[model samples]
Target: MTEFSSILSTSNIRGAYKSSQELTTSPVAPEPQGTGESFADVLRNAAQSTVETTRQAEAVAQQGLTGKVGAQQVVEATLELESTVKVMISMRDKVVEAYQEIIRMPI
Candidate 1:
């Protein structure tokens, strides 16, 4: 848990790098310095990460079936995967909402 939080804190994960006020006040979210990845690139990376996490959880559960991994390990992986999926869903909802807001805007 601590290790995971440390990793998240160090990584260039979007929202982690900026404050909520900075994000909400700006018309365009500022790209993190030095990464050079666009918003689409970040989304792609996150989607790939979610897929990888799902695969890892499946592998862990399979290992548990074979007695190579403990039930606790399997459960932890499953929980992590669930959290990742929820975050992806939230991001999707936000994107859709933003698009709807844009569509409703008067030209």
Candidate 2:
């Protein structure tokens, strides 16, 4: 569906290509042949999401402090930050451990 070249080969076309009825689906989606998103794109998206989450968390904390937000809002924000931080830290720890383990092993 992403590219006509991928779905209907340039050489020939028999009938309408139905994505669902196909006997099997591809693990990788076909692109327009050249376009690609690098690893940096994914990291950028994730960083942006984290920034937005942090902003919302801060807003909730500020509102609660100013008595504009309820206790629930404050609690929810705290929990969100706690959970996000926990996941990030765990990921970081795993990456670091993997790197260290790799360094200790002979090539």
User: Considering every candidate listed, which one attains the maximal TM-score?
Assistant: 1
Model 2's lDDT to the true fold?
0.56
Q: After superposition, how far is residue 5 of candidate 1 from its true place, in Å?
A: 16
Give lDDT tens digits, candidate 2, residues 1-107.
36534533322222112211121222376566457655445445545655666788899999999999987667666655655555456545866898899999987
Task: Identify the runs in model 1 with alpha carbons over 4 angstroms from their true place.
Answer: 1-35
lDDT of 1 by residue, 1-107 (tens): 34655433233234322322222232356667875666787677778877887898899999999999987677667766776777778778999999999999999
Q: Number of backbone collisions per candidate, in order?
A: 0, 0
- What is the Cα-based lDDT of residue 61 in candidate 2? 96
In TM-score terms, candidate 1 sits at 0.69
The residue pairs found clashing in candidate 2 are none
TM-score of each: 0.69, 0.56
Off by over 4 Å in 2: 1-45
